[model samples]
Target: MATKSNSTKTSSSKKGKMNLKDIPFSKERLIELFRQMLLGRRFEEKCGQQYQMKKFSGFCHLYIGQEAVAVGSIAALEIGKDYVFTTYRDHVHALILGISAKEVMAELFMKRTGSSHGKGGSMHFYNGKTRFMGGNGIVGGHTPLATGAAFASKYRGDGAVALCYMGDAAVNQGTFHESLNMAGLWGLPIVYIVENNIYGMGTSTERSCAQPELWKRTGDAYNIPGRQVNGMDMLEVYEATRQAVEDARNGQPVFLEMLCYRYRGHSMSDPATTYRTKDEVGQWRMKDPIERLKEQFPTVFTESMVKDMEEEIKQEVADSIKFAEDSELPELSDIWTDVCVDYPGYPGREASDNKYEFPYEQLENAKK
Candidate 1:
């Protein structure tokens, strides 16, 4: 499979902006990027379909238009060596980070086969084995966690870097400032990326932010270098993030603001049209990132090749859905498992001698 990301390899940048001819990557590599991006798009489209069918309950956020930012930026970091943290909008991030579509779909279906054993649901996705630290539901809740992950790396004398992803709305939270201040003061290896998708839920960036240029203002406050890039352009996002990851590896923290937009509402519930206009949405659709990349490889990505890739993505999604459906639901007794609680003198004779055993049938009524 073309799952290996080109961003894993290092590439030196030239003085000016990059074009298709000057992207410093091979045709196969570019096509792979396109393929992964299409996979993410199709995965989210399936999510939307399942949500409408009520396959699962609870809030669902789709990363429909922001595929370039997630795929391109993630491609720059080392898979296991580097860590990624994000907010509630994390399905695409999980997919790009090598989490199988089957596992992610299982999570959406709340099956026992999910990454978090079907417990975390759509918002709280945890896969510590891959160092993807899971997604936090609260705004700016995971910034300090990202900072701590970076601190642990530096403390252990490892060269790992933490990539903290947040939406534009989270920049205003107190943890954002506190985490950045510590990261800058301690020189932690972390890259803070703001996915500035123009809207914070229903409000526009212009209306919600006192300083609209998040990369500049936020970075300047912490004495960190920052850059704003065209998030819609996958190549631009890749290059910018690659450099930022390099800087972090060299013991420097950096910030980035990606100017992108979401095609769907903030969540499944929000219609997304009440605050924004249809004309504005159509204008952004015109700049569809996948179509733009396809234009760059008209000869290489012939009609047949593009069709094959699309069909492959469709089948991949279908397989994932079947996997989720086939998976069994968690047993009732599962509630008592995987829960970490501290008991006084645990693992000692004092605790063991004090333990009481109750019959499974009477357990519920024996609470008193």
Candidate 2:
């Protein structure tokens, strides 16, 4: 399945004056993109608030400054047909990939109404209907799963592509390299995107990765073509991902390094000020993805329209919080469900029958 190498290209600059008619997307489509990014931003903000209030108990990673990477890349794929796999910093990706804000929030809340039915909390959101594989917790762990998905697509001859997203740190993981090797060898239809936000959990990429230039990391070893895109600019992300998706669909595996930023700390626990300076953070904020999009097309995004969108997103976030609050927690029996296929002697089957015989005597004894 080895395919010919495709040349890596950078995103075209949208500098100088550009008319509304000259924009690639239609007016309604651009507005939709803006709304999605805004929704992601607002939803994550509410998540931060809830985590601080002790609404959920787990490691919570917020996607504050990296909206464009998820929204723009996903906007290029055929949703429900192509598959998506993201890292633990996954709320925004889940929302962008068609998992409802309500379901995602419910997952964060650890309620049964969550995408994972409460079993998988904030870091493992899954929805088969939307082809969202999961919000995997282990760094670079899900890359192989995404690769396998692409292999399946190739085996079935389905023109579907797998978009695997990871943090800058995950690129150094052994699984990341292994997955890329297999994808490159098999010519799988997969796009590996590294959201190079400059840090891998407080350790800056420069201090961590031997080659901080992540896009250049793939070509020599795996024969995979890589491109770096301005992840702060939504249009640039979309355009770059669109081309990558096209190449991937043709059995040409591609790699994209999105130059984005995460305003929040690695997780809820870190204040993010100890390592990076406030001035550095402020500089990145100046190039916020949402603001960049609006500035690029001022004629398209009117002040009133932007206000209405913000208000609408505010209500939506409120509704999601309410939905999460009202949802029920998973039952004790749910622990055994969704674990294995039904068989005559399987633990889940026996548990379902109330036999409750298992190696973990504590749980079985408790049932008795």
Candidate 3:
């Protein structure tokens, strides 16, 4: 059994300190950990810089500080069997699911070679091969779709799972409750992840949710089990997700509400500094999931570990831009090529009739 770790805060007013003594900690794993967070953070940072330069445009929600939720949760899933679905803050999630940074960047650049054929941009991302279910721009709309996917897994007896994630504010929507009730009743093979980032747009969670224990949003309505976990610590997020995954595999759909905070605004347009105090951001910065882990592991680690990570990630980010820029855009005919399939005047067409592709554009608009 993995030893349970409880986080402790630096201040007495804080909850608990960060600890990861139980899990097998290794330099390689830690390096990979740093890589994931660094990649996500650097990618988001680059997107912002690019947006300013007009190299990339259109709705971009940077996931600068929320890397832990994507990386840790992804570590718990078996790719090709599990599905990744989330709200508009989705680039990191898609990347963690193995979407190439180059393709993601190309999409951001609106080049036809990128994911969604350059349709998704920064907020909407998807890759069928990676089992990434794409990002939903709607507030709480994807909840039902994820639930339906989970229900499909069970219906097919595929031993698969679906992870549905949403913001703390999305809980206020009617679909959130409707899906929770459905999942609870049917015992779907899904893990409900409530990313309680403390605020929804300009509104704080406290002001937005009358009961800020937003994880318990549907506690009274359904008997589905749920728990609150610290979202800032990667290992803590990994462990909780592991437990929830196992339970869901064993016929119990678990709801995990990770108490997280975004260091940036809701999107590129919204100014996060307005609602959140710098002191609050500073406190959370000290408890950075990557920094906290570096402090915990190798017993006697040095400064080089952090510096080397930065250097390596910087080069990697540079290479990613090169790759995306070098990648060729889709041919003009590709627009209609992927549109619809013909009868082909061949047999077995009836056997392939069950396939369906998401109408990404229409869905994105309807969501807002």
Whichever of 1 and 3 has more TM-score, that candidate is 1
Query: What's the residue-level lDDT of 365 in candidate 2?
Result: 90
Best by lDDT: 2
For 53-165, candidate 2 gives per-residue lDDT tens digits of 99998999999999999989999999999999999888888887778999999988989999888888888887787799988989999999999999999999999999999
> Which pairs clash (backbone N, Cα, C closer than 3 Å) in model 1?
none
Model 1, TM vs. native? 0.87
Model 1, stretches more than 4 Å misplaced? 1-21, 341-368
Assess candidate 2 and give its TM-score to the true structure.
Answer: 0.91
lDDT of 2 at 14: 66
Worst 10 residues of 2 by lDDT: 1-10
Model 1 agreement with the true structure over 343-365: per-residue lDDT tens digits: 33333433435444446678767
Using lDDT, rank the candidates from best to worst.
2, 1, 3
User: Deviation in angstroms for 280 in model 3?
Assistant: 2.1
- The digit string of per-residue lDDT tens for model 3 on 102-161 reads 778888887777887876677789878878887899999999999999999999989888
User: Per-residue lDDT for 107 in model 2?
Assistant: 88
In candidate 2, which residue ranges exceed 4 Å CA deviation?
1-11, 15-17, 343-368
